[model samples]
Target: MGAVDRYLQEQHIDRYAFLPFSACRILQPHKLRNCGEVKTVLLLLTPYYDGDAADRNLSLYAVPRDYHLFFRELFAGLREAFALDHPGASFHAFADSSPIDEVDAAAKAGLGLFGDNRMLIEERYGPFVFIGEVLTDADIPCESGEVRECEHCGRCACSHEVCLSSLTQKKGELSGEEKAALRNHPLVWGCDDCLLACPHAKNVEKTPIPFFKTDKQYRLTHEMLENMDEEAFSSRAYSWRKRETVLRNLSLHGE
Candidate 1:
């Protein structure tokens, strides 16, 4: 284990991988300079609280308080630590909205199993994990770990065409076929058919992060949305789309 690994362990973060910063694929050319001075990328698997067995409509990812906020809070300490150690080194922390392709980067770093549902599934946390990164100028070597592939059992229950998540997040009115699908779909925000159907979702451990464990919230009601302020909206994963987008999906199902 290296200093980077020690940092992860000290932070109680067990699921992490390191790769060269140059290996990142989705970052735009202009933004590449943000990481140009960085030699190593630290990929982190941060877990959120999936709700209890309530058959709730919200996606598992949204069960916790805004993860982007939580991740920034979580990684802030690491950034400071790295800066102290490297003296003038730069570090940036990103959750979902960063330009980097987190999933592909995690796969390249041999972090977890790639599922047909297009999620990264780790042994302890399953696939219900958020991928984040800390790009730094430190010369941390990539973890010499094995990357796992999905079983390819062809058991995936959802497709891009019928994926409720994609259709709901899409701007403008829903297509006729999409509206028809929404009418029967169980969740108002995200689709979990593929997640629930995966054998990997079974028998996973609860998240150790205090933010996820102590501050779990499952449902997202119309009342909640009506009361949500800008700060609240800007924190969660679904905030990229406007409030109207969520309301449109909710109204389609009469929720």
Candidate 2:
């Protein structure tokens, strides 16, 4: 387990913690069925916020390429290396589609605190990070840290029901109230209002990860989307919602 920690640090993983499988809040047990009696979970945090964009029409998180693809490639190499070191152990990596409750597990591992906006707020990265995990059958010894609460600054008081980010991703026709809320919304894909309002999020350091800083698309115009093929679009984080959803949001923004 100590060697594993050193290796992960060398790989430039921002933060990591080892958690027992029993301590994790499993949401999708079937996803881990083939892992063969998971014993320990390695939680990792990868910060993705490069910087704020002045001409941004998309969420800060959506400006870069999809993190899901990055995690897939990363975990693949890690699994191969760990297999060489641990002869009979099994390791499986998961990100957004993880079986366990990622935020809860991360908090319990002493990685960060729960923000009022329902996001994991790491002290250094605020909420601008992606959580990933590696499940292994090895009984790695580790300490389960206490979960702490973030400062209730009331900045993220808005509920999910009225969240602009959630509203922008809705399919089909939006109601008059929804349309009105989005009329002057700067983001066509997601919102960053809560993050911007939070004091902990202020003056945060930009991501050191090179992947997030390269090939960024801060603003997405209709012409750009019109010319993009499926492959090009799929590379973006906002592409999961497809072109229709974004286009609809843009239209509502009076683009």
Candidate 3:
């Protein structure tokens, strides 16, 4: 274990990989270069709340509080704390809000394999883990080894055109054809068709994080949104786009 591994272990993070910052620059050049003297990049995978059959209506990712905020809190003061142990180095942390292509970073770091649906698939957490990173000026060890390639088994059953995750977030009212498709679908917020179709998604270990294990919901209902105050709405990932977007989706779903 190196400095990066020690830091992650102390923070209770079990899944991570370290890569040269240069590799992260290649995948998302426009987004990752501005963090200042980033020499090594650490890719961290944190699991989110993944509900079982009762919560099938919601996407696995949204089952927890906004992961962007979750990671920011988890890595709070990490750079300064790390600097205390090693001089002349700076660290910065970012989650999904950053420009880095997290899935690509994780894939390249050998943290997970890329599924046909473009989701990074980990053996333990499947595609439900959130990817975060610590960018550092330190020369952290990077013997993460090769990227694990997916078998490309052509097993993903849902096509993007009809993917409910995209369809529910469509800007305006659903088209006549789209409305016909939603008639039988139970979700108004997001879909997990691809995940449910994945062979690897089955029999994965449940997330061990306390925050993810409790206090989660499987669906975003109009009633739930209507009842929330400003603070409650503001804190959630689902509400970042605002209430109207969800209302629009709910209406389209005939809720």
Best lDDT among the predictions, by candidate number: 2
| Whole-model Cα lDDT of every candidate shown, in order | 0.75, 0.84, 0.73
lDDT of 3: 0.73
1-255: candidate 2 lDDT, tens digit per residue: 544655666667758888998898889988977888999998999888998768889899888899898888778777866776666888889999989999989999999997777788888888898999999998888867777888898977764458798888888889998888888677898888887788888777778777788889899888788899999999998888889988888777666
lDDT of 3 by residue, 1-255 (tens): 545457666666799777887676354556655667787887889877455757455567767666776677778755655676558777777787665677777888888897888889998888778888878788877754555767887777676567777776666666788876665667766787877688888788888776676557676777887998998777676776678877877666655
For model 2 the local lDDT of residue 141 reads 88
Candidates by lDDT, descending order = 2, 1, 3
> Please, what are the lDDT tens digits per residue for candidate 1 over residues 112-187?
8878777887777778888988877778656434446889877775655666788778889877888888777777
lDDT of 2: 0.84
233 Cα displacement, candidate 3 (Å) = 1.5
Better of 2 and 3 by TM-score: 2
203 Cα displacement, candidate 2 (Å): 1.5
Best by TM-score: 2
TM-score of 1: 0.86
Pairs of residues at least 3 apart in sequence or in different chains that clash in candidate 1: none
* Model 2 weakest lDDT span, ten residues long: 1-10
Ranking by TM-score: 2, 3, 1
Which residue pairs collide, candidate 3?
none
